[model samples]
Target: MNQVSSSNASLLGATFMLGAGITFAIINVITPIVTWQMGVPSTAVVFWQYVIATVFALPLIWRIGFGALKTRHPVAHEVRAFLSALGVQFFAFGFASGVPVWQMVALSMTGPFFIIAGATIFLGERLTVQRLGATIAGFAGALLVSQIGSEQFTWASILPVLAAACWGTVSVITKYLTRDEAPESLTLYMLVLITPNHFLIGLILGIAVAILPAGALPASLATGFDFMLPGGDALVLILLLGLVTAAAQYFLSLAYKVADATYLQPFDDLKLPLNIIAGWLVLGQVPGILFWPGVLLIIGASLFIMRQDRGRLPTGRSPIPETA
Candidate 1:
């Protein structure tokens, strides 16, 4: 790719990433509320969301055919799907557990740090001093936002952090796969793999809820495992969840296609503020005093990492080597 074409691609990728961020923020806000309102289990919600995404993606797969799906890295796709499923399940659990949207969003800022760590460990990327410092500061911020010393801290608060870690692993694997795989193929295979996994998990959980004694299971899991059929507004929201998720996933794949993960990762920070606004408008929730400062630290850490990378790379391209 020439400089001009690369610049254009980067611009397009950034736009796609921005769109992904926006749609995902909406998803973050709406999915939990929809799950709670409909009394659907988290795994069930994930299953439907992916089922919808797979349905929407089938046309593209039909156009591209089976050849596009061929890859030497089937194992990689499976691993990515597993990690992504774990991340999605954890996130859904966090939201359904009554953790505030903004707080969940804030903790999710830890994702980039985990991404950096994954890149370093798995991708053979070097960890610079600035990156190390930024990662530490980012975690410190997360700890502050967690308010562990306060009575408000609960195990539920940790779910988003686990989600972030899983997502970060997915991001690293994605960066690796983008070396040879088309983003569409990667996205398609992931949905194909995980949709069934989620359904099976949901089914098992539903059965457990039916068989187990009332006090046997944790309250959160019990509530999350309560399977209910959607109706009325809940039905509409369920359908929208699938469509919105598919769109978001597509945009995200497009973003990774044209740009390195490092180049696009910073744009993810936009979701926090977006989620904050969405939380206030849609859910009437507001962050407490410590939330703002913690968010700032997280954002600052991401910027610092970006700046360090910027100084090392050429003006228009990433220094990170692409694998063949």
Candidate 2:
């Protein structure tokens, strides 16, 4: 609908969304190989990804200068960054745990539901009929994808669900911050703060691991507490990760600039399939059958939520960690 489309075909927006999809698919595919296979710590990967992104953003930082850092909402920014960094860590852990890419991506779609509920609870927004229904449907979809009672299900399988909740809470906080904070301040604060938050969390975890005996924590939990920098092929993949992360963010900016979110919803959902296909091709991971039906419901709920939320927030500004 032109209600969301800025132009006839919304071609530019669709193209940018597609570009983001491809890059995110690459990120989803490679993260596991770096953590699950190459044995890089998940926290290290999360820290470096933001560090690399910060490095990439130096010019913009320099251009904006220190004045952009003067925000009254410093604590809010810190909390948001903490939550966001944790979401990134959880996502990496899920990937490292070898959850099928499609399932992870599909489950991540539940973020919108949390966002909606948070808006109603925290932001004092009304929960309309459509959004309430969408939230239920979305969670139902997530449950199907999760397959809670299936033998294949494990604690690691739920990490992305936790990630979705964290990301959604961050989004709600972002919405609250937007009431007063400038966009530049928010972006600058996030870039500057996320890395340190990640490092601190990693440090605490590493300390805990050291204090505890061997086998105290599970392999997935214990794997990423070290301070090691990746080398050789792992280093190259992480660098590629940094590059694509920036590219995905850029594409999101471009896409959101043109098409309103409701119009771009379908294109954004392409990441699920793109990640799924990439996983099958590169990692030989086949999605469980639940993925098909689960993804459909998730997509439907996301579209409905986006449609209902069309004008409440800034257009094209996604708080979900689709780029991360």
Candidate 3:
């Protein structure tokens, strides 16, 4: 009976991971294709993306206890989480505007590094040497992808790095807040709280781009919200992307809730290959030899972390503290 249950759990974990990988890959490809092909401003595209994501998430929110956001001390943890989400929003838009899914997803592979830093600093956890080495290797790969060669480093290459850092922060923050809050409640707050924050960011960025001098906009930012709709096919793709986005967030929150950071961390490495494949299928992206090495570093680091969980928590549904 125990063996059967363990097998079942492993199957479920694989299913959840596959679902996450496919959804995220679809979103990454859809965002860029919609904005680039449809002639919609990047900001406008992002605005509609968030709007659609929120709408799609609504049914799930209602099915759960979303109204819990109205409870006392609502602003305490939720606000911080919302800010963390804003960083994710910026990364989403940034990738959509400038980078391909290959680079965006590749850079995002560095998230575990930020996770380790956040765990050590914010969650009072100790950092492992393996994690540190892996992070350094992953960052080095990022530097290469960004074209940060000896004498010519561009800001464009750096933005994705910042975006990955933000992603790591989101994971840590989610882990921290999910301690007392149920997964449904935490996801609910994230949806409701982040909606306004992202909306305001879109609005402000839109205004900034419009008012900025001609060269200023391109040199400093790529705005997406230009008050135009993508074509019919593009519109359809965006809607589908929204649905996928909603599901991904829900599953990710659930995973964080039901598992420890160390146990579940290895799964996040799956995104690297997923993105690589998406890039190949959608954009004819062919990664060079350097890409594989960097991916290996990220994956190796995640496995090391997972290996450390050998005896600390049970194999399935371990109630390890989410504070990290």
Q: Model 1 compared with the native: what TM-score? A: 0.83
Q: Which residue pairs collide in model 3, if any?
A: 41-224, 42-224, 42-225, 43-224, 43-225, 44-224, 44-225
Q: In candidate 3, residue 71 scores what lDDT?
A: 44
1-324, model 2: which lDDT tens digit per residue?
654454644889899989989988999988999988987877788777767766776765676577988988888889988988888888888888877787777787788888887888988999878788888888888888888789877778788888888899988998898787776677667767777988988988888888888898878777537667678998888888887777776677668667777788888888887888898999998878876787788889988887777777665453333333
Top TM-score: which candidate number?
A: 2
Question: Residue 83, candidate 1: how far off, in angstroms?
Answer: 1.2
lDDT of 1: 0.74
Positional deviation of residue 137's Cα in model 3 after best superposition, in angstroms: 3.1
Query: What does candidate 2 score in Cα RMSD to the true structure?
Result: 2.7
**What is the C-alpha lDDT profile of model 1 across 169-199, one tens digit per residue?**
8878877887777755765676567776566
Give the total clashing residue pairs for model 1: 0
- Candidate 1 residue-wise lDDT at 138: 92
TM-score of each: 0.83, 0.91, 0.81
Candidate 1: worst-modelled 10 consecutive residues by lDDT: 315-324
- lDDT of model 2 at position 299: 87
Candidate 2: segments with Cα more than 4 A from true spot: 1-9, 212-216, 316-324
Question: How many pairs in model 2 have backbone atoms within 3 A of each other, for residues 3 or more apart or on separate chains, i.e. clashes?
Answer: 1
Pick by lDDT: which candidate is best? 2
User: lDDT of each model, Cα atoms only?
Assistant: 0.74, 0.79, 0.62
